[model samples]
Target chain A: MDLRPLKVSEVNNYIKRLLLSDMVLSNISVEGEISNFKHHYSGHMYFNLKDEKGKIKAVMFKGDNEKINFKLDEGMKIVATGYISVYEREGEYQLYVKDIRSSGIGELYRAFEELKNKLEQEGLFSQDKKKQIPFMPRKIGVVTSSTGAAIRDIITIIKRRFPPCNILIYPTLVQGINAPEEICRGLEYLDSRDDIDLIITGRGGGSIEELFAFNDEKLARTISKLKTPIISAVGHETDFTIADFVADLRAPTPSAAAELAVPDVMYLLKELDNKYDELKSIINKKIKAYKLELENLDTKLNLYSPLNQLKDKKIEIDNFLRDLTYVMEKKLNEKKAEILELKGKLELLNPNIAIDKGYGIIIDNRGKLVKSIDSVKLGDEIGIILRDGKVLSRVENIDEGEKIDEFNL
Target chain B: MNLTYEEAILELEKILDELESDDCTLKESIEKFKRGVILYNHCKDLISKAEGEIKILLEDEENTKEETFSMEV
Candidate 1:
């Protein structure tokens, strides 16, 4: 009857003690389908064990889960042995699992785990050993049951995506006892041939026993040995078969396998069109560049031509010729005027021109023109020349007086 | 121009580079143009040509003749 207030952690601790003291609660077993499984990075596994009626939280430390031989998967039927305890921080009770065992249809899961671990150890699933899937596979070889929905789906998808790609369907038993051998044979046959570019082996969703063929040790080994890249698509996306790990690629389903194996023709066509356009455009650009260059060269050649310079020189000569003609004409006009003036002066000196105006000239007997009176003497003979005739005369009387005007004479 | 698709593309790129350079003469550009045309035609031919129809193997035996498969599985 201690009704005093207690902290949340103290209450949680009290419940934890009560649960641990109970003999049955400390050592308990739980069987349910696993849900929300998470193997934390810190090496602790957290999950929920749920049945149709109820569910419980469970955690298994990495140390204990490491001893677990089988792979834990969601929705797996497992019997977990653990003790119930209260986590003080959350104030919630949870199962601290010590170990887990498979139950019901777990035999097949155990076999799958065993083979996966063995093949993984043998390096069959190594990334370096994986072959690259061709981007454009020439021909694809498919091994699946002809009657199953898997083949139908693969064919439909491959055809829808790429029509030109070649597919060689190797219809074989995808299940039953003979399925493993037949699948191996189909794979081998495809591998031995040179025409086969890639291989896809798979089946539709089924039970563990029905899908057991894909988990066969021999089939996984054979898939690993294939030179051609293979894609495994057995069962649903949740089912991970041994062949899925061994194959070069693992598609979630059969339809996905076809999608991975062949490239879409539409996408390839688009890319090819782009490249083709680039080539044409580049060539056209080259042509345009050449044309521009030709025009430039042509212009340069024309500018360099001597005909243009010759024309310029011709105009220059024409100007010089015009100047020379003007100079000659000016000189001739000046000479003509000077000659006219000189003719006037010469006429003034000419006695004939004076006689033409009723003047006379005198010369001595020696035929010299007497310009001064000293050249003449009294009673000396002289000559007078007129425009019409010439006459002899005498200097009859010499007058010393200086006032002889024309009217007086 | 008689080379593979990849080689033809590479050659075409080289020709483009040559055309872009300043020192390439007119005569050299014409020659490169002709070569580029040939390479373009070769690439187009390679791209257009595709494989034949899909087929299914008849049996486990090896043979060239195969039945042309259809969409029906």
Candidate 2:
């Protein structure tokens, strides 16, 4: 056969076209263990997929590598999906991997576990680091898909429980490759606003892959660093994510998170009413106690009142005056009777009365009265007076003999 | 009189605590009781006046806009 010698470039181009034309070779899945894995600074990944018998080189460009949910390492068994094509410069055929996945467990799950363990050891899940959820948040920021059921449920629950709170929604993607970055941005946006009191970040129920964005380490760290308390409400009740562990509070669903973010106004009002009744009762009791004390003081004051004491003193003085008047009257009557008896004696001893009864008085000439014969001594003259007449007589012998018969006057 | 719901509730609680304490005088208790009544009424008014309105805040490079938000189910 007469054939022209093909150039090296032509040969590589032919093989490249041949592999690209084959449908089976163009889109295939190859299962092998990853070896000699090298992540280039250009965001491309180069590795070799080795089976028990053979090995093939693979290269994943930055676009495809960006979709990888887990870090690639040597010896990890995976299934790479892409076409086998020849490199023109190297003169080698390799698999241009479009996607890679772990053979048994999902790559996203592995990534979730890996990041969870790493962050747990770093104390991002520590309870003391979590902030306290505000009891009554005036404004709540919700980070999730705006059109999804998660936001709808959160808004409904929040409105029902607390109507006064303002709900601020930060629309974000919760799944796919760009989900982690978008979610981080949403959190940052809410954090930047000073008016937001609390943050509720989450999505509705989904598969592990769909929930993988919450497993991102950077997102978890952002949640841990937030000054405003965050409530993570991801997927169903059974699902848990790294965001759940790092958040200040966790709710099984978005509605539950909304319920936790605000307080029920009706219940608070009832509590205030109870407090009001208690305060009124306490004040009444205090007033009653004071009234009783005043009454007791009044009784004590009446007992020692000066008006009552003056009444007692007046009664005492009246009794003393009566006793003094009675004693003085009795003494005066006794003195009057004694004085009357003395006056009667004086009247009986009167000489005029004796003379009126025929008894005469005798006197000497010199106006001396003689009571015995020796005192007369034969006086030259003597005068005698009877009741109404006087008689003159010469000295006469006075009978000294025989005490002169007791004269009966 | 312009007290917020939170402040009113907090003040009501303080008044209740003072009234319950033995150290409070009768005149002081009465004064606090009057204040507590006013606070309770203010809180009740706040709760009754609240109309549950949902609003969405849309912020772009140039301006921020507020629109009434309702769930489309």
Clashing pairs counted in every model = 0, 0
Scanning candidate 2 chain B in windows of ten residues, the lowest lDDT window is B48-57
Estimate the TM-score of every prediction: 0.55, 0.57
lDDT of 1 by residue, A205-312 (tens): 986766888988999999999999999999998988899999999999999999998767677567556655665665577678778989999999888889978988
- Go through the candidates in order and give the C-alpha RMSD of each one to the true structure: 14.8, 15.8
The model with the greatest DockQ is: 2
Give the DockQ of candidate 1: 0.25
- Candidate whose TM-score is highest: 2
Q: What is the DockQ of each candidate?
A: 0.25, 0.40
